[model samples]
Target: MDQSFLLMLSNLLHLHNHLDPTSALLSDAHSPTSTSSSSTSSSLLTSSSDAQWRSSYGLSYPVFTTVVDKLKPYIAQSNLSLPSDYAVAMVLSRLTHGLSSKTLASRYSLEPYLISKITNMVTRLLATKLYPEFIKIPVSRRRLHETTQAFEELTSLPNMCGAIDSSPVKLHRLPSDYNPSTYRSRYGYPAVQLQVVADHKKIFWDVCVKGPGGIDDAAHLRDSLLYNRLTSGDVVWDKVINVRGHHVRPFIVGDWCYPLLSFLLTPFTWDRTGSPAQNEFDAALMKGRTVVEEAIGLLKGRWKILQDLNVGLNHAPQTIVACCVLHNLCQIAREPEPELWKEPEESGPPPRVVESEKSLYYIGDNLRHALADDLYQRLSR
Candidate 1:
C-alpha cells in the first residue's frame, strides 16, 4: 500500500477516537442554548476536532506554497490589494461552483469583498489578454489565403471566406420599454444580441454586441462596424465585381440578410422547378455558411458560461461580449474538428426551399447565371 494511504488511515482513526460522532455536544455549543461556560468547552472541542480533520484530509502546506509562489506576478499587478493567485483561484472556484459570494467566503476562507474583486479582475484579464488572439481581423493576404484553403478543405466549398450570424444571449426582462426591446426572442427569450463573423478556422474576425432585440439582422448590419469594413475602400480585390467601381474586390461572403454590395457573395435562388445547377449552387453556398453554425456549437460547448449566463443589469451586455471573446480564445487554444458541429436538439429552420416556381426578390436569373459562369471558370482551372 502507498505510504500516503497509510498516513491517511492513521489520521482518520485519531479523529474517530478524539471526536464523538453521535453526541450533540458539538452542535449545542454553537447554538443559542449554550451558556458562556458550555460555549468555551464547545469552542475547545471544535478547534481540536477541526485540527484533526485537517490532519487527515487537508491539502499539504507545500501545495499551497507552490501555487502562491507561481501566482505572485498576477497578484502584484491586481488592483485588489490582495495576492493575485488567491484572488484568481477564488473567482474561478466561484464561477465553477456558481456559489454566492457569502457561501464562497465561508467555504474558501476568503473575504466576501475580496471574492468580488477577484472575479472582476480575472474576467477583465481574460477579456483583455485572451480575447484578441482569436478574434481579430486578418490583415495579411497570406493569412486570408490560409483561412480560405482551410474552409475549402473542411467543407469542399470554393473561394472560402467566412461565416456570419447574430446570436442573442438572453437577459432578464426589465419593465422599461428601452430595456424590454433590448431583449428579443425570435427564439424563446429576451436577449442582448451579438453579431459574430467567424471564419473557417473558428476564429471570430469581428464581434459586435449591444444591438436592440427588436431589430432585424439587416438593421443590426446597418449600425455595425462590420458594415463599415464592407464599405471601406482600403480592402482591395482585383478579380471581383465593381458595383461602384471601388478598389475593394468582392471576396467576402454573407448570407441573404446582407446587402447586395459590390464585394460580397450570396447564394443563387432558382425560380420554378429547382434546376440541378441551382441546387448544386445552393448546396455549395450552404456548405460554406455551415462553418459558422459549427463554430457556434463548438463555442457554446466549451464555454458553458455562455449557455446559462445571467449578468446583472450593469454588466449584462458587456458580459456577453466578454463571453464571445473568451469563446474565440478557447477556439484558438484548442481547435476541435468537424465533430464540434453536431446538430443540437433545437436547431434553426430547415434548409431553404426556393422551389422552381416561387418568385423571390433577389432571385436575379441573369445575375446568377453570370456569377455562376465566373465561379465555374475560376474553379474549373
Candidate 2:
C-alpha cells in the first residue's frame, strides 16, 4: 500500500490504467489462498515462443537445461522431482526479465506464495552452495601470477591483481517500521551496495554485500574480509616482484574513493594536478580500475532485476550476492553478454576524510609518488 510498492507495481504492470493486466494473474495467483488448498501445477508456456525463453528468463533452452542439471542435486525433493530446475527458472524470471511473482505465478499456473518460496530457495542455493566453488579470489601463486600478468598487460603497471569498485542496486523503499534511512541511496530510493573485485576479463573474484547503499566505499571495503586479510597479511602474495628496481606489492587498483595502501593502490588524485609522472600513474591506474566497473556493468546488464531489486530488504544482500555468483557461472559457461545492455549511472563517491592511520597514509603517499615518477620517466622515452 506504500507509495514505493505502488511504484514497483505500476512499473511491473506497465499497462495502461484502463487495462487490467493484473486481474487474471492476481486472481489466479491468489486462488490458492481460498478454502480449496489445491491448484493445478501445469507447465509455464505462453503462446509466446522460444524467444520467450531468452526474453523472459535470460537463458536459452540449452543454458536453462544446464542450470537445471547443475542445481538438481540441491533442489530435488520427492514432492517436487525437478524442483531445482523450476526454482531456477522461477528466480530467473524476475532476475533476467523483472517479472513480478504474481505474473510468474500466472505464467506457471502456480500460487504467488509458491512462486516466492521457489525464488527464495533457489537464491539461497546459489549464494550458499554455488558461491564457494565459483566466486573465489585466486590465492594460489600461479593463479595470482596469472591475474597480475593480466592487469599489468592492461595498464602497463606491474603486480596488479584486481580492480575494485562498488555499485548500488536499487531496492524498494522499506516499510516505515523498518528504518528506511539505512537503505537510502543517492538514486533517490533505497538500495544496497555491491562491492566487487574483478580481473581484466571482467570476472568477479570477490564480492562484499554488507553495505546498505549509504556507506562510503572506504568504510565498506574496510569492513570486508578482503581488507582484513590483506591488512593482516593473511593472504600470501608471490615473492616481491621487482618492477624496474621498484618493489611492487601485489595490489588491487581502485578509484579515488578508496584509500591507498601498501597492498591496495588507488589513484594519486582524480584531477590532473600532480606532476606528469604522477599523472601518468593515475591515468594507468584509472584505466586498469575500469575492469571492476565493466564487471559491474555486465553483471547488472545481464540480471535486470538488480536494476531495481523489487525484493525485500532482508533478501537484498543475498539476492545481490547470488546474482554475482550466477554472473560468474554464466561467464564460466561461456554465455555471451546480453545485447543492448546499458550500464546504470553509478552513485558518486563521497569526499574522503582521513580519520586515522597517518603513518600508513604517508607510506601510501610515498609509494604513489614513486610509482608515478617511475612510470612518467618510462613514458618520456
Candidate 3:
C-alpha cells in the first residue's frame, strides 16, 4: 500500500473523530433512518423510486440493480458484512455525490476504513472486470456503420467514426515524494491526463490515463495504446469512402493540439485563414469534436468525483476509468443526463509533426484537401 494512501486514511479517520457521526448521518437526505442497519441499506436498495435512486446513486433503480446484479458475484466474494446491493449503492453514492469515506461512513453507519475498502474494491472491479464489456471499439460492421452515419448526420463529415480529446483529472492532494510541477496542468492544478475517444452519442470507446497533467495532449496521446494500434495498422476500420478520388478511411478528428495522421485528422488551421473549403472542413470537424467535449462534461457532471478527484495517486487512474465505464453504461441505458460540466477555454499552439509519421502526414494532408473540396461542392449543391 502506498504511504500517501495510508496517510489519507489516517487523515480521514482523524476527521471522522471530530465529526458528529449521528448528526452527519442524519443530514444526508438519502441516508436511511437513524436506526438503520445493513437490513435498512438493503431495503433502501429495493425501495427507492427512480428519481430518488438517481438522486442518491446517479442512476435509476433499474440501472442501479443492473450494476448490482452484474457485480454481485465478485462483490459477494469480498465477504463484506453488507449485502452486495447495499455495498454497491454505498460506493456509487460516494462517486455520485463526491462524498468522502468519512462522510459515507457516517451515512452508512460503518467504519471509515470499511467505506474506503469497499470503494477501492468496487471501483477496481468496475475499471478492470467490467471495463472490456462496457467500453469497446465499434468493430462490428453494423455498429461501425451506425456510428459513422450518426457522425455524418451530426457534422456532415463523411466516414468520421469518433472524436478524440484529452482532459485533466485534478488531484485533490499530491503524494509527498512527487514533484508538483510534473503534475501541474494548464489549469494550474495537480492532475493526471485522461485521453478518450467518444463516438457520435458521446460514448467513450477508448480511454487512456498515461501521464501527468503537465504533459501536453500530443505527448500524452503518443503514449496511448490507441495511438499505437492505429499507427501500427492493428485497428483497421473497414468502412472507406472515396472523396474527390482520394480513398478516405474512417478517421477520428481532434483539435489542433493533436498531430494529423492518415487515421487521425486535425484542423488545418485555427485562425481560419485558409481557403473557403478548408474553413468549411475545419468548421465541420469542430462540430464533430463537440461530441467528445460534451462527453467529458457529462462524465464529470454525473460523476462528481471526477471534478475534484480525491482518490490517491495510485488509485486515481482506476477511479477515473471506472467513472468512464459507468458513464458508458448510463449512456447505453439512456439514463437522464445531468447538467454538463463546462471546461475553461482551451488554447495551444499546433502540435509539431513527427519525423517517422511524415509519410502518413502527407497522405492525411491530401485526404483533408480532397475531403474539403468534396464537402464544399456537396454543400454548394
lDDT tens digits, residue span 1-381, model 3: 344433433333333223222212212223233223334335334544677667777888788878888888898777654456656766787799888776656753557887788889999999999999999988889999999999999888889999999999999899989999999999999999999999988999999999999999999999999999988988878888888889998999999999998988998899898899999999999999999999999999999999988777998999999999999999999999899999998889988898988998999999999889888999999
lDDT comparing candidate 1 with the true structure: 0.50
Score residue 197 of candidate 3 by CA lDDT. Answer: 97
Cα lDDT tens digits, model 2, 168-224, are 788755657865777777566787888999987788889999988777788888889
lDDT of each: 0.50, 0.70, 0.83
Misplaced by over 4 Å in model 1 are 1-75, 89-116, 154-157, 172-178, 234-250, 269-274, 335-371, 374-381
User: What global local distance difference test value does model 3 have?
Assistant: 0.83
Candidate 2 residue pairs in backbone clash: none
Of the candidates shown, which would achieve the greatest TM-score relative to the real structure?
3
| Model 1 poorest 10 in a row by lDDT | 53-62
Identify the candidate with maximal lDDT: 3
lDDT score of residue 310 within candidate 2: 73
Query: Which portions of model 2 miss their true places by more than 4 Å?
Result: 1-53, 60-63, 77-82, 106-108, 244-246, 339-356
Q: Measured by C-alpha RMSD in angstroms, how accurate is candidate 1?
A: 13.0
45 in model 1: Cα distance from truth in Å?
34
Candidate 2 — worst ten consecutive residues by lDDT sum?
A: 34-43
Q: Candidate 1's residue-wise lDDT over 13-36, tens digit each?
A: 232333334322234322434333
Estimate the TM-score of every prediction.
0.62, 0.81, 0.88
